[model samples]
Target: MHSSTDTGPDDAVGVGAAVMLVEDDRRVRTAVAAFLRAKGFRVAEYDDGETARRAVLDAMPDVLVLDRMLPGLSGDDLLRDIRTRSDVPVIMLTALGASGHRIDGLELGADDYLAKPFALRELQLRIAKLLRHRASRQSPLAPFTVGRFRIDPSLRRITCDGADVVLSGREYELLLFLLKNPDRVVSRDEMLREVWGWNSGDASTVTVHVRRLREKIEPNPREPEYLRTEWGAGYRFTPSGRSS
Candidate 1:
């Protein structure tokens, strides 16, 4: 094994953050990525929303830069699909003619919108602002309290009855996802696509994350108090003292 340290910037494209750009045009992709990277970010480029979606799960970008017109999956469809699960920040880039598309993207779930033929500097600024805003908004809920546990997203810290608990990023994402949607039965596929963006069979990964989340957040760990399993479907987040 080898010891390591961060090679990326303090706010790496997504060290604790990332900006995912999904554009079909290579020119735009290169230009945008270079601009973002120049700004001290960890940037991931995708050609379309489908791939972007997968990357989003895998990389967990802090913000998504989505082009309105895509090849296989339309940007609108991707936005709608994303809304059903995660609330990762999204910014839509559309052609000037597609003004209606811009409005439509925001209606679905996009946090911000921009028209094409845009300035690289402006886009970089937009993504930066969104990421900063998202981070700020997250803290109040990061170390959220259930019955006895607290989830800390920043440090990936967890505490139960004031005792220290550690959680992996995947576990933190899955558990935080569920906690935000308390009392709901989240399906495995949804968790996969949203938490880690697994398009295929990754049930085991989901299981592992959930189990880890339970071990840290659950009071009994044997009989989980927060993360609950649904035999055939998936899992649920039960705020403490809630009955199954």
Candidate 2:
């Protein structure tokens, strides 16, 4: 039941952003929390999944740093719960460095993943990137429609055929990026750079999110009409909902 808040310096880069960090290891949590605080983020630290789950809604964090393993309710279970309730950005931390493990985390709705033994600076950068994305979504852009989907940027809401389509924060960003570039092939690397703010990363991350988006928007994900694979290339989004 360990929890505490560190209000970082007033002028730090991360100032005004709230970050919820759930990690069981005291040593790691303390170190990470301290570093984030120094960078000017309001960090709420938790030592286990169950406690973090209880505090999540109340905290309403800008970004969540969640460990893959935890006592009581596993991180995966907690993530599932979070997804059901909120689209708060999540960055999963795990000891597993395998690509499969990363894909699993991303598939489970994590906005980002960081393998253990990573540099503190890298983690901070990831958090900052997520914060930047969140901030960008708040921009007041005129609502637009492409085919059956209507996107209201001011509300960060999307509806398909007048029915609300719930999407994770990352999912919305990915879909919006594809919609903005309709009828054009967008490489995975380009998606990563433009959507995920990553210069280089596993293409599987983009693949997993694309699959998720298809399941939500396409009547039949097996034969996706909105998002189509380009095999040797990347992906093409068709606003007309027809394979071209």
Candidate 3:
């Protein structure tokens, strides 16, 4: 519904953050775009997923607000396609507020999800939080050594035994957090808040990410060396592996 050239004022905290909003509903899209623009976010609005997808592939935005249901392409499929190429943070918006739907979105690599009939302020807050977390991760820092693995936050890269290890954005963030708090048991609740920037959500999201991280970083995911579960407590990161 809106052109890619549309931009807001350059003075707010979200001055440089562009939000690509993909929603088929005219009423919802218009209202949401107005609020975001008022808040000083440059917005590129689309009513169909195909156009939105192409736009993002051409030039990824700082964040994406996607609707689960859309014409041309469904949000779920679009999300899957994006995961293979970009790590731009995504927030799913839909009338489907069921827990299963939320879980599916998270599993598909969405950074956040908000049900319809939600507060506009909450959406803005969520976007702000995600951007802040992203900025913090890019802060200059020395490479961290954890056993045979080395993590460079600035470059957003990780290596194991000097070999490159691929990781998703969320996985990288989780690993970085665990590495920073080595030797301590970090509860799932704490992880949700600190690592995911989520005040509350399903604990399984943390579990899923941890499992994926261990698979890539550990010799065996079944019996992880660096990433260990604390059973009733949560998870513990052994910087020096099991030998430590």
Candidate 4:
């Protein structure tokens, strides 16, 4: 494992954020770590999945930048393990840019995906956005009820029918966004911008999260009661469970 820090200007968006970066390529890992450090982030670099996994389980980072292909445990396996334990936002890096591969990563619970040979500046921006979202979730807010679901913002917990419903970080955010805009049709582009903090990205990311969220929150995912798709537009959340 390698680490980098700088006494440089701390005005960057990731100033106080600790970033865990795992990549098999020494050159890439070193370069990415150096770049993030210069941007005011404390970076811990690891060369393989197993080492990174141990470190992550020990102390979760603010954000994780993980390569899809790794030495021992492999990126997919590592991500699976991490998701089972924590909701730390993950940005997956891969050489494959195919839509199917991106979808698979999202299904595995990645918050974001970036193809390799990516610009360092883009990576920095993505990290900054994620950090901003993480910070926002901490703000205190009164708990509210929407249909069968009761949301407690302060605790970041949701319960349905008095039973706790487990949701990933991304899923929680998506559900919160929908709950805030009840009965309104929200486009995929809008969801990407508002929820994922992306100006442009594959819409499948939203679709995958929606599917996962429905599985958790909806009694029948096949016929979702709350989250309804508006064909040709996007999605709508009807807290009353009334069919449109």
Candidate 5:
């Protein structure tokens, strides 16, 4: 469920991002969520991974703060599943001194990892940094080529092999965002903010758009080329349509 409450100060950077927090511990979850809300983010908190897994597919938050030891699906399993279809920037929290856990999380496509007993401020700063990093990769206003797909942001158009490929408003926006971050894994959170102007919403909107986009650009949507899913990460726009 999505709960909207204001916390912190209005002076916090008003990026209006939404954060989904998955933690089994009530105390830790409550404290961290309070801090995030204060930082001017909309937060949806979950106590277990099973419920979160279902909710995330429908209502994908901009960022996910996941704990490794979760009930039901477990953090690592949930992360692995999310990476299959959606690229939502995930920051995983593991036990202190568990180097193996940290390594496993990263290998599973976690954007960042944190040990328990860390400062909330540090988590805040990490989230801000991740958001900034994603923003920094915004594509300039220009036409670009990714494989046979020719994109004209100025014209809001795409063409494959000289044939026009029509896209809906959302489709156009999604494609543009991907093209801008070429060869990089773009989480669903970044897509929602940049393309939909939403701090939080159904992530299936993104999943649908991606499928439609692949239909138009890829030679075969079932076996995609230009738009590929990075397991444990997110979607990537491979410019050459060929894996390097």
Candidate 6:
């Protein structure tokens, strides 16, 4: 049976946003997709990692539900592949229950990983929290002046030291979030739920987006003048104007 709550849409959210569901389990896939559709989400179902990967390449979805194991490609492999190109949030669904494997998956770059035999309510809660977090980051409520970067949320534009720096929708959101928080360590979970939405629970989404953000706003994506990694903790943005 389908299970989800808060599927309702208001003036702020798109009622017809498309969600791509990739679960190899036929029964689960059918149930999840139907439930999501009932909640006003447009869903496309895929049964394999490879197919899901291809579909995402063709068109990015508003959300994703990816199974951890697939015949052609391992769920982890597909997760790695997605991170290489986009910061789309991912939540991994797996049958494995080992903490070690879960840790490995997070280290490999998943934003959030959920083992199989899960509850639909838990999944729904996670998805809702993640989407809301992401929307807030992307919204960019006001202009943020950070070091050499000045961001105008209304225009969805950014400039560095007076030079215009173009940003993709994802990049702008990631940068604005980091700048807004400034110097505080923003965890992977925070980035995933707030910046990318919990499409898939792979933390690598945060890394990729941060890397891309650095490339655009930082003086050097390598050294990262503005954005800095806090090792296992997460990341922080120290505006160039801020004194050490």
The RMSD of every model to the true structure, in order and in angstroms, is 14.2, 4.2, 4.6, 3.6, 10.6, 5.8
Residue pairs clashing, model 3:
none
What is candidate 4's local distance difference test score? 0.87
Question: How are the candidates ranked when ordered by TM-score, highest leading?
Answer: 4, 2, 3, 6, 5, 1
Query: Model 5 TM-score?
Result: 0.56
At residue 242, candidate 6 shows an lDDT of 46
Q: If the candidates were sorted by their lDDT against the true structure, best first, what order would they fall in?
A: 4, 2, 3, 5, 6, 1
What lDDT does model 5 reach? 0.75
Better of 3 and 5 by TM-score: 3
Model 4 root-mean-square deviation: 3.6
**What TM-score against the true fold does each predicted structure earn?**
0.51, 0.92, 0.88, 0.92, 0.56, 0.62
Better of 2 and 6 by TM-score: 2
TM-score of 3: 0.88
Candidate achieving higher TM-score, 3 or 6 = 3
**Candidate 5 lDDT tens digits, 1-244:** 1223433432354258989999999989999998787777888999999999999879887788999999889999998888766666678987753666666775565667788888887687667766664554444567878766788766767787788976644466677677768888988777877765546655555666677778878888999888998776778898678855
Tell me the spans in candidate 3 whose CA falls farther than 4 Å from its real position.
1-12
Model 1 ranges with Cα > 4 A deviation: 1-16, 97-99, 141-244
The CA-based lDDT of model 2 is what?
A: 0.87
Worst 10 residues of 3 by lDDT: 1-10
Residues 14-58, candidate 1, lDDT per residue (tens digit)? 333567788999988888887667667777788977887776666
Query: What clash pairs does model 4 have?
Result: none
What TM-score does candidate 1 get on C-alpha atoms? 0.51
| Candidate with maximal lDDT | 4
Q: For residues 17-43, could you state the per-residue lDDT of candidate 2 as single tens digits?
A: 888999999988998998888777889
List residue ranges in candidate 5 displaced over 4 A: 1-11, 140-244
